[model samples]
Target: MKSVMIKNKYWDIAADIYYPPGFSEDKKYAAIISAHPIGSCKEQTSGEVYGAALAEAGFVVIAFDASYQGASGGEPRYIEDPTQRVEDFRVVTDYLMTLPYVDENRIGVLGICGGGGYAINASMTERRIKAVGTITGANYGRLMREGFSGFDPISAMEAMAAQRTAEVRGEQLRVDDLLPSSPEEARSLGLVETDLMGATEYYRSDRGRKPNGVNRSMFSHQAAAVGWDAFHLAEVLLTQPLLVVVGDKVGAFGAYRDGCEIIGRAASKNKKLVELQGWSHYDLYDKPEPVGMALEKLIPFYKENL
Candidate 1:
């Protein structure tokens, strides 16, 4: 593995390129770009787990930090703009095409968590991406507009409106934790044993914590994300082969349902949904069993389609 940087109009993306064992520059190899979840860095689950795992499976892989987050450059840090995130995928694709050891025609993408949704949105128009795969795919817009059980939209909208107004009035950006800071805090907030608890354990614990992986994100990000749909025009525009993976045990607001929705709406005749039994949304991030299960299917799917 080697560190590399790709310059985009908005920022220079920090990335790591993982070479397959015994790789040679003389031969072109199929490549995959792995994207981390929102408010995460490349060194987190996406790069440390799936990127390395896929490289070991004989594919060149690149994992990158999203612009305005982690090591990537941009102003007003931690902004989670879905449109810009999708464009980041395209810019990475452009970088891959320039590599001498990468097979331009066989490039694929793998996105974890919110990155999955961004991958789907990117694949719609970026036909150069021949194959796309998503793990625990989440549509941030849907989540922001409608909470887990679809009961918090009004309150959520009101909060967002208040925040936007504050931003317009020149208030400092408000940053909030994406999940509770601790298991006890989660329970206190009535999130015990739910997906939020699992997420807190992963992001706030030794299991997956990294310095740049701080759970905080800007409140203004919601303004941009609330209206963006990852599956917009997926029925007519997403012709590339798609693979959506989710844990069978994932609960409400989990990407399992989003995966199903994508499969139902996508025009691709070659799409498939694979579920990892007994796994939760966060379990797939770095847990050996679930990550292994995911790669078993992902390796062949990209091989066959890319």
Candidate 2:
């Protein structure tokens, strides 16, 4: 395995390349680019685990910090603009194509959690992405537009409009704290016990916690409510093969179903949806038992499609 710096005009994305043992530069190999979820870094979750695994599986896998988060370059810390995040995928793909050992034609992508939406959005514009796979995915646009659906619509719209106004005025808008600051706050935020149980685990537990990250921020420029839709171009994404993987848990499963229903409605052919039984959202993020299950479906999908 080796590390390389991939730079572009807008940002410099740091990537860790895992080459199969005894890899040769003379022979081109298929490549896989893995993207981390929102508010998370490459090394903090399942993104790193599967990146190393897939690299050992013979594909040249690269895991990168998205443009603004982790070790990558971006400003206005913790801001989550949907458009910029999707572009980060393109930048990663652009960098990968320049490698001599990578078969640009066979390149594929795997996005975890919110990254899945970006991956799908990227595929809409990037034909170079031959295949795509997502784990415990979420559709940021739908989540923002609908606010967990059946929950509240008026509040969601007001919050979005407010954030948009703030962004336009260059005012720092509070999107969300990375996590609840205290036990009382956690309960107040409703993150402690809800349908998103896995979220509490990921943000609060050592399984995927980080010291540098904060639960809330003044301006998450990419607030689902304020920023551009991650799936705006999804209607035209059928040209590339897609694999959508989800856990059995309600929160994650519901999002997966929504994504599939939207893309499947748009795609012409070559799409798959797999639900991992007995697994919750956080399980697929890092737990070996459940992640292994998700990967089983993913490996075959790419092998056949890519």
Candidate 3:
């Protein structure tokens, strides 16, 4: 793996590029861009799990930290802007197109969780993406509007507006944690929802924790997410080949339903949906069995399509 930076607007996006064994600039290869989940960085499942596996399977892979988050550059960090997140895919695709060893026309994408949602929305117009695969994908806009699990968007928006007003009035920026302090706390609170339970174990613990993945939310900038939708116009514009994978566990985050929605909504005639029974939304993040099962479908899909 080689760490590199790609310029996006005025900031630099921190990314890790993985090359297949015996890679050579003289030969062109299919490439896949891997996008991490919301509040998560490239170092988690995106780069460390799926990215590595895809690279080993003979395609070049690049996993990047979205701008304004992780190791990427941006101001008022952790904003979770849906538009900016979708744009990140295009910026990374631009970088991929410049590499002599990468066949731009054969480029594909793999998005996990919130990243999946962005990938779908991005592919609608970024025709450079020939294929799309999402694992436990959630539409961040939907997630926010529903208050990350039906917690009341109206009340949440009211608080967000208040925070923005306070900041404009010379108050300090307020950052909020995305997860509970620990997995134990989540369990004790009866966060039995697969998304919350597994997220706490993965992002908040050594299983996938990293210094750049503090999982914080920018209070003042959150409302930008409410008005966005990952599947917006997908039924008409999502023409690229699509593949979606999800675990059977239906958490409050509703990744399972979102996965089904994309499959139904996308215009791709070659689309496919795979369900891993007995697994939960977060299980697809780092669990060996589900991950392997997912790649079993993904490796062939990219190879055949790209």
Task: Give lDDT tens digits, candidate 1, residues 7-117.
Answer: 999579889999999999999999999999877888988898999999998999999998888888887888788888988998999999899999999999999988999
Ten consecutive residues with minimal summed lDDT in candidate 2?
A: 213-222
Preferred candidate (lDDT higher): 1 or 2: 1
State every prediction's TM-score relative to the real structure.
Answer: 0.94, 0.85, 0.97
Model 3 residue 14 lDDT score: 97
Ranking by lDDT: 3, 1, 2
Candidate 3 lDDT over 230-286, as tens digits, reads: 999998999988999999878878888999999999989999999999999888998
Candidate maximizing lDDT: 3
Candidate 1: deviation at residue 147, Å? Answer: 1.2
lDDT for model 2, please: 0.71
TM for candidate 2 is 0.85
Error of 1 at 119 (Å): 0.5
